[model samples]
Target: MCKAWDRNMYKLRFIISFQVQLIINFKLIAICSHQIFL
Candidate 1:
């Protein structure tokens, strides 16, 4: 049971980190586009 809980926690953490990374990448792309426009 403990192992299952731990695995779930790891999955949740991984998802959050993945989302954060995606957000950062999106922001970077937006900034690059804005710079090009200016």
Candidate 2:
């Protein structure tokens, strides 16, 4: 049972980090496009 909980926690952390990375990527792209338009 402890092992299963640990696995779940790891998966959750991975997913959270992935989402954060995606958001940062999108922000960078937006900034680049805005600069290009200006």
Candidate 3:
């Protein structure tokens, strides 16, 4: 049971980190597009 719980926690951490990276990438793209428009 403990091992299963640890695995779930690890998976959750990975998903959270992945989402953060995606958000940062999106922000960068938006800034670049805005600069081009300006």
Q: What is the TM-score of each candidate against the true structure?
A: 0.95, 0.96, 0.93
RMSD of each: 0.4, 0.3, 0.5
lDDT of 2 by residue, 1-38 (tens): 99999999999999999999999999999999999999
Best-first order by TM-score: 2, 1, 3
Whole-model Cα lDDT of every candidate shown, in order: 1.00, 1.00, 1.00
Clashes of 3: 0
lDDT of 3 at 23: 100
Lowest lDDT sum, 10 consecutive residues, model 2, at: 1-10
Q: Please state the error at residue 11 of candidate 2 in Å.
A: 0.3
Q: What is the lDDT of candidate 1?
A: 1.00
Q: How far does residue 14 in candidate 3 sit from its true spot (Å)? A: 0.4
Candidate 2: where are CA atoms >4 Å away? none
Whole-model lDDT, candidate 3?
Answer: 1.00
The weakest ten consecutive residues by lDDT in model 1 span 1-10
